[model samples]
Target chain A: MNPQPSLNALQSILETLLPQMEQGKFSKVECHFVRALLEQFKNHSRVFAELELSTRHLKEALGETENAANTLLTLAEDLQRDERTEDIGLQISEACAFQDIVGQRLKLVQKTLYSYVDFLALMGTTTQTSPATIMSGPGFTGEVISQDDADRLMG
Target chain B: MAVSKDMPILIVDDFKTMLRITRQMLAQLGFMNVTEATDGVDAIEKMGQKDFALIISDWNMEPMSGYDLLKHVRGASKTPTVPFVMVTAERKPENVIAAKKAGVSNYIIKPFNAGTLKSKLMAVLGPF
Candidate 1:
């Protein structure tokens, strides 16, 4: 699957969220958590960069193979066809290497998210305000729905 | 002196991914002699090692910001005349004015493509 759109979405979310967190009237500890979350996004960004570089290398190889294909068409030898197939296989192997890196990154993101949620829960219990309310602050306008509302919307 | 593609260029960002992406973009522009630094302090250390032809730095970083780096670069006798470009996601007027005052040669916003990078390099280096 193409990671471009997902990466763009993640980037957009980060761009919109960071400045607000920086400017928000959150407590010192809350701001510390926010900074840690930003660090987590750095890991996410690395995964996306690795994916982009892998795809770019794969595309470059395919472009070269296309140029070679023009010459191989006239030659039409079994050996040339095998070599071309091998080149594509090598690209696939290179792409698979990226899959391992992405998997590791995803696990890291998941762990960070869990820790953030736990921190939010702790804050909610201590502050007597929901995590969403604390996050949105006073003038936030984004559409935020509770789990019940989300289920109703899904129905 | 005319800009040469092989001239050493320094790119500094706290984000490793941004450093990688900027290096790739520079490579696409046929600039292969690029150095990466994680932040302003690291950049200053690298500057001590080699005289970079150009420095492209992200504005936001912990401990030492790109703005501070710009000030340091301009104040230092060794690299005072080198072209300095600031890359930032923020477009605040005051920040731009401050960077200009600090001797930034050019500035580029974040999420820029290779074409934008090339254009910024051209503006600073006078058509490389």
Candidate 2:
């Protein structure tokens, strides 16, 4: 009995038998989950930005309303109430414009979510290997997809 | 700038937000007379109805990609000189080469800002 081949010798023998260990790495499903999570992170970021902009717009509108109220209060006492109503109207219009911006941003976020749905579908259908090549946004990653690559990955 | 702000410009994209954002970017550049089409076929229909001073279009679209539209525009009679700019989420060199070979005036990638849009337009329209 050769001491049952020392533990170090067993470790070296195992390394010789299998040089690559694929077991420890994340599977395709796990990778998909990771990619999807990253995508959600991006989606949340967009929503957060939208919310910030919306809040700014709301604040502006509130400030405008307050200005109008105060100015009207002081002016009513002085009998100049009709003078600054136009200013209030203009401010309201500007504030309303913010709604349009928020509307567009929300729509953009919706589109992003829709794309994410397609990605989720791909993840579900793909097997053996990660279906998507982990496509990257302009600044997020460097790989570019061509028409041919797109067809293959999509398949 | 040779191109006037009043000149009609056509923008084609599949996304509504992109259309609005691109229009807003153009507006920031003093271009108020901008028109939009949701896809290539829609853009072709619009193009048939009017002569745009400049045409800005997205590259990826269903049933008819921007490359196909570019080919149609390039092959169309009496519309050879129309400046066509292709915008895309894609940055593949092959697409860029194909677009340039098809006579695209300028190419810009997605996630672009006001500055990139402005510079790309200026490259095509000559310092607007």
Best TM-score goes to which candidate?
2
- What value does DockQ give for candidate 1? 0.03
Return the top candidate by DockQ: 2
Candidate 2 residue lDDT tens string, B1-128: 47687989999987676787788778777999999998889999999899998989887665677788889899999578899988776567666777878888888765455667787788778876
DockQ scores of the candidates: 0.03, 0.12
To one decimal, what is the Cα RMSD in angstroms of model 1 from the true structure? 17.1
Least accurate 10 contiguous residues by lDDT in model 1 chain A: A132-141
RMSD of each: 17.1, 13.8
**Residue A59 displacement in candidate 1 (angstroms):** 33
- Name the top lDDT candidate: 1
The residue pairs found clashing in candidate 1 are none
Candidate 1 deviant stretches above 4 angstroms: A1-155
**Going through the candidates in order, what is the number of backbone clashes in each?**
0, 0
